[model samples]
Target: MNKLSIIIIFIVCLILFIVLSLSYTKLGTFDTVISSYIQHFRTRPGIYFFQCMTYVGSIRMYVPVICILSIYCAVRKKLLNICFLVFNLWGSRYLNQVLKLWYQRPRPDIHTLTTATGYSFPSGHAMNAAAFLGFIAYLIITEHQLRLWQKTILLVFTTLMILSISISRVYLGVHYPTDIIAGSAAGIAWLLLCILFHQRFIQ
Candidate 1:
């Protein structure tokens, strides 16, 4: 997308984040109900699948990919791409930490299917996955030469990747749906900001 479109999206996401944050703070009935509903549909295989996806979204997985990508970028001397990637991934992570602290929201009090310890206003996995995959999708769609089908597949895959990771966080009982929504908004906002800045000043 173009700069204007990205800016608009960023604004929309920020607005969404604000709305969700408010609802979450009040513990909206819908939030509680949906959280229950999502957890209710859980199956053994589904748990395994999402757990694996959550692992893929984890810092453990992203760290190596970030290192390898950064090294390749360094070797190729692609400074702009390197900066954008780091900002979208690593910087977004650090920003999420600040946000979690600022909000000081607590995780669910239910029995968790997985373990995670942190204030859970915004899910780290959800944010990081959104930022990383959103950036990759932007790069692929804008910088590459591909057929329409190829672009469609990439977009679809990116969407699924983001959705799966976010849903996993909720399903695992570590995050509420609002937390994931807020996290996604925060992540995509940062990603779009980086893309817009990179385009205007670096490109």
Candidate 2:
């Protein structure tokens, strides 16, 4: 998509996040019902599956990938790409922390299949997945060497990763559905802004 379209999506995501934040208090029923519904499908195997998937969005998992990508960029003499990659990933993380602190929303009172700390209005996993993986998808799409079918496969895989990580939070009973929604929205907005900046100035 063009930069103009990216800007429009960014604005829409920002608006959606703001609206969700403002209406959080009114979402108690929605959150409870959805949480219960997801939890109902929880089995030992399912929990184990999500536990593994959730780690895909974790710092420990992404850091090595980021380092590898950064080194690749450096070897290719694409310093700007390294900067963009680091900024997009780390920036999304910092934003997630600030929003969690601002909201201070507690984790779900339900029995959690996994351990988590800190506030949970917006899930860190969801946000990081959306921003980091989403940016990677953008990079893949823009790569001229990749065939159209190759790009499609990579994008579909990236999208599945993002969605899996987001849903893992809810299934594990560590986040509300709205938390995933808002986090994804905020992360996507930030991702689009970064892309727009690169297209307009860095490209």
Candidate 3:
């Protein structure tokens, strides 16, 4: 891993550790308020909107798009860039699942707005959204020589996409605010780890 990426990963991990510790100790009120706010956003219209956005954010269905991008990079002989993209995408998903099992927190059962099954502490939707869009943003900034304005636009759009997907999980009554927060942290950490791996071994 590059020194910068390693530093970023370390910082993210430290923050996550602190956040998780605080959540179970002194942040009870904070967690409750955030969870309530997320639950309040689970109105019918908002739920529908977020659910639709979640479908749009589905990485499984989007793999073809990633494949297309990867192929374009390969044709241009940017093999290392392709590897980074593919590895981040797959590795992030794997890490998300692993953390979900590790956390093993149950989903909210209060409102009965939507039926969801599985552990919910770390929202998979949020993690996947962050990983997918965050990697796209990284690729745009690193691999593609886009103009500054183009990079800004891409970053804004990807950020919105990730936020929308995260909101959807809460609106669907499947994940708590803390779940999404942890998922986002985990996603970022996974991306950083992938970058580190590439810098250390692949580069």
List lDDT for all candidates, in order.
0.86, 0.89, 0.74
User: By lDDT, is 2 or 3 better?
Assistant: 2
- How many clashes does each candidate structure show, in the order listed? 0, 0, 2
Cα lDDT of model 2 by residue, 41-145, tens digit: 988899999999998889999999999988887888878877888999999999999999999999987678888999997889999899999987787576458
Under the 3 Å rule for N, CA and C atoms, how many clashes does model 3 have?
Answer: 2
Error of 2 at 182 (Å): 0.1
- Per-residue lDDT over 1-203 for candidate 1, one digit per residue giving the tens place of the 0 to 100 score: 77688889999999999888777867667678988999998999989998999999998998898788778778877777777887788898899999999999889889489889889989888899888888877775766689999999998999999999999988888988889989999988988887887778654
TM-scores vs. true structure, each candidate: 0.93, 0.96, 0.83
Q: Looking at model 2, how many pairs of residues clash? A: 0
After superposition, the stretches of candidate 3 with alpha carbons farther than 4 Å from their true spots are 21-29, 41-45, 200-203
Tens digits of per-residue lDDT for model 3, 12-52? 76598447735743555766687677777566687778778
Position 49, candidate 3: lDDT:
87
Tell me the deviation in Å of residue 60 in model 1: 0.6
In model 1, where do residues sit more than 4 Å from their true spots?
Answer: 71-77
